[model samples]
Target: MTIVLAAAAAALFGCGTFLLLQRQLTRVLVGLALLSHGANLVIILAAGGRGAPTFVGGDEDRALLDPLPQAFVLTAIVITFGVTSFLLALAYRSWLLTGDDEVQDDVEDRLIVTRWSVSEELIDAEEAALAAHAEDVARREMDEEAHR
Candidate 1:
């Protein structure tokens, strides 16, 4: 039924999105595959259910099925398969180069997590305290020189 297909598509899409968020390259690849499948299912459902061939036939009572969607889904499937294979190969290469399939955080992400966690006000206060200490030390050095 259409309802069942819709539910299946939604579930696949949700699962795929969840997997895509993982750090592992393998999981990401799998997620992409699931997402592609969900999209294909939606496309087929949109076209309509299975019926007679789209081409003109002798049977006047038979409903002709639209073939455009089927053709499109087939093409998309082939493309997705090729792309998924390439991505899997890349993930495997990454694992061979390192020991794990998990992707490392980029500099930008690390900076956002670490550098932005410190408050600007706190940093300013710390800098001011250090400057005051430096000035006091310099003043003492000058005083000792004057006494000598």
Candidate 2:
């Protein structure tokens, strides 16, 4: 059923995302595979009901099934396989070089985070100042009205 396939796709995507967030290269590769499978399932589901083949002498009464989704899925499968193999090779190289497949944080990423935090702090301070200024203006207007 469509509902079952949809649920399966959702589950695959959820698990893939969870694994993709892991630091280990193996887990990331597995997650990528799961994500690709989920996508393929979605494409097939979107293709709708099955009908007679588009080949010659096919049933004229029945509708012909669209072959585009199947072609897309096939192309995606090939691409995914290539990417997976390349990543596997990279993981193996990393293991060879470091004796582990765990990815380390980049220095550039840390620097970016530090800069972001500083900017965020500045924004908070600016917001606070604007809020105080608005309050002062409101208070002065109320006082002037009261005096008048």
Shift of residue 133 alpha carbon in model 1, Å: 36
* Deviation from truth (RMSD, Å), model 2: 17.0
Over 4 Å off in model 2, which ranges?
50-61, 108-148
Residues 1-148 of candidate 1 have per-residue lDDT tens digits of 8889999999999999999999999999999999999999999887766566567872767767777888999999999999999998988898897888889766445445554677877656666766786898899999999989
lDDT of each: 0.84, 0.86
TM-score top scorer: 1
Minimal lDDT window, size 10, model 2: 107-116
Error of 1 at 17 (Å): 1.2
Off by over 4 Å in 1: 50-62, 108-113, 116-148
- lDDT at residue 28 of model 1 (Cα atoms): 94
Question: Would you give me the overall lDDT of model 1?
Answer: 0.84
Model 2: pairs clashing at backbone N, Cα or C within 3 Å: none
Summed over model 2, clashes come to: 0
> What TM-scores do the predictions have?
0.68, 0.67
